[model samples]
Target: MSEIPDAQPFTPVSDVGEFGLIDKMKAALADAADARDLVAGIGDDAAVYRVGAAGSDGPSRVHVITTDALVEGVHFDRTYVPLRALGWKAIAVNVSDVAAMNARPRFATVALGLPNNLSVEGAEALYTGMAQACERYGLAVVGGDVTASARLTLSVTVVGEAEERAVVYRRGAQPGDLLCVTGDLGSAAAGLRVLLAGKDRMTAGDGAADDPPQPDLTGFAYAVERQLMPQARLDRIEAWAEAGVRPSSLIDVSDGLASEAHHLSQAGTVGAVIDAGLLPVHVQTALAAQRFDERAEAFVLYGGEDYELLFTIPEAEASKLSPDTYAVVGQVVEPKEGVALRLPDGNRVPLEAAGFRHV
Candidate 1:
């Protein structure tokens, strides 16, 4: 007798989404889980572990590891993105995860796949950007791999070290804590809009979101630059330590404020209320928004790639943080209240995680 034919075609990964895919993978491997030394696994920014007598400082030391990848057609485009900036961005993304853990980045290993079109100079420019990032973030590039591929890809793995107690987790937010963010939001998204518009004009009015053009980038210079070369707020991480302020919970805003805030609150089993008026938007972001005939606030809440820190702290410590360093944009509320956002005109609504999607 013939066997039954397949019941259905394979499901598209997009349907599950990035985080959903991660959960599926973790669950598939859950049976082999070893939890003794694993402080955190697949759910957060980085993996945290209890390091033993290895870090010079002995048992109190904890280790964190995070990896990030940038691909030509997926994570970036060749049209307006500079190779150097892309390199810096790849490093910044991984380092941002380390910062989320409130850990000091110590070392990184890069594995890059180069296309035939990239010249020695192009490769050098990319490495230079990564070098700058490493120096700025106090990290060393110990080793890496270089390979040839049809498309360019850069994968960076970062290792960070910190005292076990100093490491922040996304699950520690308390109901009375204040919601905080470092630096401004929405600038990068504005810049991406400018680039896309320029490309469309170059393609003779086709608005397809691919291809390249050396578009006049002065429309919103700062916003465009932010899209290409964003910083990872490492200095602010240092300052938080300097002030002796340990955030009750922490995350980096790579996906966008809305998505990140939801992630943090859900992980912590709490809720948040974001004040729309309290979000700090850069001047260039506003200008870019007007040029595109869009609301500036949209980018602030939903634009991804700001790479800023989203955290929560006790009200007492929150009061001590300077406004220049931290913006208390909201407060953790009871889980019964749910995650909500307060608009400028005094309307409150559910905080939706409707931001950039990687899948």
Candidate 2:
């Protein structure tokens, strides 16, 4: 006698990857017909909502929200990461989104999935770091859920508010606008490489008999700090607002310049020209790239998690920005031109993202 087994459906996540899956699932979710309050959805940095009558003036008052999650083994390595830094990153990344919308973070809720290996002291350290970041960003932790899991997982949701007129989005750039960025690029990814380089070198017999092998993270401290505890560009956004330099389009550089630029250009129905020589590179990032037998330009174009601001402004408004802090990287062009990078040698080539993917 043979036994029959029930059939199970199978599909590979890699077949579609992150963006494709988002498009599919987004198509499946039906939009509300009479949803007047919804300002932005699915594709943007955050979901925007128009609250009641706060539009006492011309523009409506809006609230923006975003969520992010990090998992052990997939996003980070336990051998190198500290609990406090992990906690700060969990909240800082979300706050970066709120900043992108030209808003200030007001509240947050945390949901944690913990494994048995973590202790009460570890939990306290994590919260301590979260609290410090909340103070820095002028936000408060409202509520959350805690559950058991095989490894540590953290999810954070943030809420922020702004005037409708002040809220910047991905889809507003026009031709002739100058592309710009705050601070340097690619340091965080280089830092991760330095960290991994140490981890990959360790073996059971490599250290003294009594002591375990430890990564000597000296001279490369800049990269390590950028990777483990990068700060969102909150001050720059605020300064821009005060200086009356409203961006025609804006995005946070969580992914590299190329990927985020593609997102901006695609949404705006425009084209872009990323200038390779104009990219700001930290000294440590350059040295790290050389150590890894790679070029710093690749990191500047393809590295993710920099948390700097990528934005476009009219050539007229570009004059208001401080050049030392904001690097004018490129320009927006007609849609037919498509997205491309202008190399130092005067060659123009298509711009493509080489950032990470998880599915």
Candidate 3:
């Protein structure tokens, strides 16, 4: 008898990475739903669908939907990250996605996977934290499901609304558009670095009986808070609306400056050059980077979870934005030029997505 054929090997997700897997899923689900009312289905900060308003003959308003999940070991550690902060962050992250689409987040639903060892009070504290964040962002927590799990997990979904014409995507950037970002970058990453250092100190037997020595966070409070709870840049979206200016393309900076820049460039089939000198780094963030003996620019480039908005706008609209809140860091270019980072010394290097990756 002929020998049996060898079993087929399966592909690991890491081979193609997080975005590659998303691209594969996007292709497979292209025809899964009707396309008539779908504004944007996949490969965006949020999914937008068109729906008519009640008793209105005017243009349909679009609903933006987004979801994000936080896993215990992967996203946080209870030893340093408080449950309340975790809860607030869970909701804020999804809101950031909606804001990235230039929509106003109105409601949210939370799905939780609870570990059996957790206490009822612990769960309630989490919800309380979520409620606090909801109050601040003007979001209502609807309903969701709960189930047992090996570790604690929280998944938040947000729904937002906007006029059909107000929605922005990541594919409309032109060669002359200016690249901008709201607020400073890398502060959240610096915060995480501070928290992790504290954790290491505690675990290394640096505490007295019944009391432990904590990391001296006197000057790093801003960085620490940024890591534990980061606010979404919804204010920038509101500012744009008030000024009657819209970005040609928009994305939230959850995956660092370099990665998000590449995203905008690839989405628009254009090229970009990020000026290293123009990147805005917070004072506290720079201090944290120095404390860790790391380059401040590295933090700004590769620090994920900033939750700031990264976008491209026409030169005419750039003047309308407040200089205090926004910074023009680069310019869009032809596709042949690709993406590059112009160093302060005038040297240029290819800008790649070396930010956070799921895989």
Candidate 4:
């Protein structure tokens, strides 16, 4: 064989503007495999899908719906996030919203805007991740739209169904209700710190000439995994219903516990007092935060993306809940008092709103 000339190294994606990148992405995914349930896919004003008729049990089953958007650079970093994780995250976040409403997610429509820099193979990898999430959650990607855009963007709308009288909302809490949440908080935030530090180390090229040991990432890995593939609390919601436990109010911790507590307080026209000592912080989360020189307590209070359910139950019925699945974090008080954090030392402090925001 003849000798071949060497080609120049590939440039990074940042060289191209956002819109130009999207155009390249569109061209790459031009031949997506056909999906039968997709009435529309990858190019339309909105995707359309068909849902089966309501069962004969009652009036047409009520549809529970929610939408969430993930933007490159804002919600995720293309460099560190594997394509599969990215796809899973896009769907998982939407599913969490549906679970927050105490509904079973059944269908989802994913709309994507691609930049030209991404290859068809890369897009397929992303779809593979999304498909895995759908299977895991018992949801179907019934339809979606694909289009060229300035940047990589994934917008997902999930449709769910719940019995007419079973859907929960955020505005129903009353005074004397017991506030609760599923799972521990702060792991995702701790994971983010580890990721950032790892990125910095890699960029700095501070490794030994021989072979430096890889950084310990166990704690961060769990946190990052939680952020990437958070499971919806649908199982717990169903169990609560079966046990005859109805929440007086409900909301999800898309934001941190502190912010969500304020949300429930404002919506229900009541104040809340959360015991700081009772806030759940996973061991991994605490360790990760310590490695990053961050306060573990602060992370639990204000670090977002836990996605656990925050709800209220009548004081009398709170005892019926299984402690393994839920924790009584606080109590509802009259509105004029405002939300507060009762300290371990028997002092109280005003609860400030702290959580993630796009802008």
Candidate 5:
């Protein structure tokens, strides 16, 4: 008999990082799937497909699909993150991806990995929160699957639709284009810090047996609420449609400002220069950062889970947007410039992707 060779050593997924793993998968699967109707594939926020033949006017409308998974210890902690809030967050994260494509979320399919200890009522409470979010976003829960697991996990897939011309990708920004972001940043990360601190105190037996401790949320209500329940930027999409404005390139701030900025820069083969003074950090976020002896800008630049929309548009089309709701924070530049943050004192520093990494 011929001698058998030893099996090759297994490779660790962490060696490549999250996005790096995605790129490897993209290359490996390039020829495995049909590409006749595929519009956007693995590299973008969501996979988009052309629904039908092109109309007389132009190209056909497209469908957007995206999925995200939230694991117990990785994404949340039951000690501080309530069941209802956890459920809502699971759906909101997927919805944010749909909005990033400039499409309206229409349907969702949820899959739950229920543990043996979770009761019927506990599962029902989770569904209730999902229902509330579905109603608020005008989405429907079409179907799903339930399975047993050692730890709780939620996986949500959201489907959205949009006109071919309206769908935005993260690859169209040009040099001199203005960068804009919606609402504020950093509150979610600060809130998470506060929650974890509270959890640590409780674990150390901070209170009497009869008087279990609660996190002191006084004056940090806004930050705490933002962390528990994040809203997808569908409203911004609607407003853009009404104003006949479309971003050249767009993405959601789910992985923090610095990370998303690098995504856009690399996707478009350009560079992004964000002004530090222009970043819209919330007052509550600043106060929370102070309590922890951290800079608010650190939270703004590195804090994931903000779920705000960040996009770039031509300066000529800037007049279409309302200054009150959208803030121009930066501009696109040539790839040689790379991604950098312009400080208040006029010095520039490299902006690194130090945001949340799945691996």
Candidate 6:
């Protein structure tokens, strides 16, 4: 006897919207692994969890928590980015947030919604990459939930701890504080250009005609790596404490320099003047931008997702820190004049919110 096949044809997930897909996912995650720490998981206004010992001496170590969500077609494209890089990035971005707070990340939980198209092996590959990241950063993968969905979505929540005094905030910069940043900027934006160009070349019928030259990734690789697997500047946070140089204000440059400068200014109730020439530009980043016929200075100013730390220090106290590590790029001014950039050609340009906007 010949067995009859199912009558209905398989349909691609695009037919259903995000909510329908989420509902389907909830059902699949009905049976969750048992654990004592997870007070609540899934199906709630918010998931709750307990931490620390029942009774402990010393001020309850400050608990730092952050969450980030990456949606396919928005945060990443499957064609250009590998599953491993995707997993690493998913955790790196959240770790960057923890670093910005000057905290030590200890644990994380990941929740993933995958499409039918991805194989079980592909999903495991992603986990392997995330596990590698956990090993590198000294964080434990405490828990997570996985389910099927129409599109790929990854959300990670990282928990960290810090001493009360060591934690830095964005609202502390005062008048006359020197503005500084660790590492160079704009390379990530240039790397994005390279990746997009590569995609264009592959998509066009002419694989050779007018094809852009192989991206010279010398400096650009750092930026590409920053975008793929950025290291949170936790070491710098520890160094600053060791040097007794407490930042008056601090922010991570996930957005462009101008935008972060504006953030510091607004939060601290002060204005700032940044010297364009003083802005750090790595040699490779400059060369990569030149190759693409783009202005490196503009990329440094307006390019986003560099993930370096932007901080302010009192001028007198700043001298105590090692000169080899930090640069004095600007200074805080009275709130009368908004954020301005002093150009190399002896002109001043007003700064605006030109960073990456999710919405």
Off by over 4 Å in 2: 1-8, 32-34, 54-58, 204-208
Residue-level lDDT tens digits of model 4 in 227-290: 6667667778788887887787787887788888887886448999999888888888888877
- For each candidate in turn, the TM-score is 0.92, 0.94, 0.95, 0.81, 0.95, 0.79
Which scores higher on lDDT, 3 or 5? 5
For model 6, give the 10-residue run with minimal summed lDDT: 39-48
Backbone clash total, candidate 4: 12
Rate residue 105 of model 2 by lDDT: 91
Which lDDT tens digits does candidate 5 get at residues 153-228?
A: 9999999999978999988999999999999989999898888878877877655576776667888889888899
Model 4, global lDDT: 0.77
Alpha-carbon shift of residue 9 in model 5 (angstroms): 1.1
Tens digits of per-residue lDDT for model 3, 1-359: 99999999998877998788889999998978788878898889999998785668876799999988999998888888888898999999999999999999998999999999888898988998899889888899988789999999999999999998999998889999999998889999999898888888888764555777776677989888887889988888899999999999999999899899988987448999999999989999989888899987888899889899999999999899888879999999998878899988999899877897656
How much lDDT does each candidate structure score? Answer: 0.87, 0.86, 0.89, 0.77, 0.90, 0.76
- Model 5 earns a TM-score of 0.95
Off by over 4 Å in 6: 1-60, 206-219
Question: Once model 5 is optimally superposed onto the true structure by TM-score, how far is the C-alpha of residue 238 displaced, in angstroms?
Answer: 0.2
List clashing residue pairs in candidate 1.
none
Q: Pick the candidate with the highest lDDT.
A: 5
Q: With candidate 4 superimposed using the best TM-score fit, by how many Å does residue 342's alpha carbon deviate from the native?
A: 0.9
Worst 10 residues of 2 by lDDT: 203-212
Clash total of candidate 6 = 0
Candidate 2 lDDT over 1-359, as tens digits, reads 87788778778888778888888877777453355788887787887999867437666789999998889987887788899999999999999999888788999999999999999899888898899889989899999899998989999999998888899998899989999999899999899989988886665536655665666566789889988887988898788878887999898988788899898886548999988888899999999998999888777788888888899999889888777869999999999878889989999999776565534
Whole-structure CA lDDT of model 5: 0.90
